[model samples]
Target: MNNPFNPSFGKVPNIFLDRAHAVTKLSTELQNPNSPYQTTLIYGVRGVGKTSLLTDVGNKMSAKKNWLVVNLTTNYNVLQTLIDSICQKSSPEIKRLLDKIEGIKLSAFGIQFEYRLQELTETNYQILLENILDKLQAKNISLLVTIDEVDPTPEIKNFISLYQLLIRENYQISLIMTGLPNKLSELQNDDVLTFLLRSARMELSNLDLLSIKHSYQDTFAKKGITISDDVLIAMVKKTKGYAYSFQLLGYLLWEIADKKITLATLEQIQGEYLATLGRNVYYKVLQELSPVDHSFVIAMAKAPTQVVTTAYLQQKLDKPKNYLSMYRKRLLDAQVIKSPARGMLEFTLPYFKEYILENLKFYV
Candidate 1:
């Protein structure tokens, strides 16, 4: 039996995968002999297929061309680690290059090589990199380095500086990176990174409605499960084009089906079940908040509708009106709520909105 919960790393064929057009275009560009941007950055919101897309692209690039692809994800210190990982990937060549450089000691034992950058100045390091890049270029092997979750690392700034230097001096290596939505902003604030940002920005394609439907139908069909159009539409509506949510919903519904999902079972999913899911999700989000903010969240959750007014919440939470903005900023930083319109705030997690509404009394 095929696994419906494909949250794992490996790509599954015949599964409900989308983003073909975008992947194809990226493949073409990366493989292009004349392609300019040695480094590319792909950005999107979380669970929007960023990982899947990069995985697919990396697989394609590695299999077809002489591209040396390494995909690494980092939550912190990505730049130093990225350089270290890349140097590790190029270890054999690094050993060979260091061997050739006078007064440098290089030794390789088993799969590990120990060396000292102490004997080498920054200029020597740059020269060694250039020599390795030339050797790689000679072999027609472009180093495609991809780093995910790049924002948390301060080293990213340094890495970008080094990468821009390599590009300026014409290295054959290329980079593809993805991270939190605000990462680009962080990168752009620096002068060198601002220059690179303009040169190498590549946007990931979003899944369209048709792609969503096709993916749902295909995934279910593979499992011998079928869902009605109405149920499919509802799932799509709830997911709001989020790729992970779509996969999560599909996986959950497959379990709910227990055999074959039909129009009946689809419609049979009660609001209670949805509300329960929402509550669990919202509760987890609440766990991250302080006691006071949690109370403020409860007040907002107790409201009947999606739109929560500041005046009403202030009165309910017994906070002064002037403090609303402060509360709002705190929640915003915590990413609990987003202000869609002026004076109107909504939970970033829609399911949490439902969760809070039904479970507010318990928490309160």
Candidate 2:
């Protein structure tokens, strides 16, 4: 049988788990014109399924008759991409209406819109977008713009600023954006983009262990593979409820095991699993951190307990409480670590401590 689990980054897995409620909540809010969740922000650490959740929400909204969902990325000019996506995805009638706008020209090849003035400004893009939105609103259609991997680029800031204006004007538009927690925080803290601070925020945490076990059991059973309860629980704990780890571990197990799962097979694939995770997710996650942040995380990994106290970190780094607090907040904003309780901190990623220790030479 084909492997049901997918470990690739940003690709939706065949066996998705633990995000149905988020999908439902966001989709429902987008459907309601008066809902505050019309502008939603989804943030999480690497491998926690931010992109997948955003795609799912977009798919749900797109399935509705009146919702026109346009999926975009922050890689290009977000405003132009949105305008183009809207033109392409619009119904023939709506497209015809948009084609009537001065600068927009619809062709069988694709949308070709131009600025009447040679020098284009933010106002030009805003005016053009508003015109298209006007037509969409007239037809009682609501626009849902889904942007994945959001960054605080100038183009993104401009698009978001225009989005806020469109919202204020009651254009029947909604936005759902997903990004790494640090990047989203940067955008929210921008003086001009402060409106995003008020948007509905969804931080993708770890999946529930019980739910992961049930999913693994159900998936393997469908393939007629037998795995005992103890073995299954062991495998689930190995995943530590991280979404990508769950897929990666399941994929490795399915490939290595025969008719039944055995600890022997799990043992055989352990090195490959961590190595692949470091290459795919952890390396990039580390690259996002500053050198000081790296020092702080390494210190945490050196601690004896899974949870470490702020005082311990302060002493270990030989920095003052204020200094440790600054880095702590940085890591927290980056979602690299979490405060389990007052004066305590823990790595948010499963197996992250081991990853940091094993890769210490490169960072040091």
Best by TM-score: 2
Segments in model 1 whose C-alpha atoms lie over 4 Å from true places: 8-16, 33-37, 75-125, 200-206, 256-259, 262-303, 307-350, 355-364
lDDT of 2 by residue, 1-364 (tens): 8999998877767888879888889888777788879999998888899998888888888888888999888876677778889999988988899999988789999888676566456677778889988888888999988888888898888888888888889899988888988789899999999988899999898899999999889998988888999999889888878899999999988887778987877889999998998889999998889999999999999999999999889989999888888989989977788898999999887789999998899887
TM-score of each: 0.70, 0.95
User: Which RMSD values do the candidates have, in order?
Assistant: 5.5, 1.7
lDDT (Cα, tens digit) per residue for candidate 1, span 139-164 = 66687877765663555676667777
Prediction 2 TM-score vs. true: 0.95
lDDT top scorer: 2
Q: What clash count goes with each model?
A: 0, 0
Cα lDDT of all candidates, in order?
0.63, 0.87
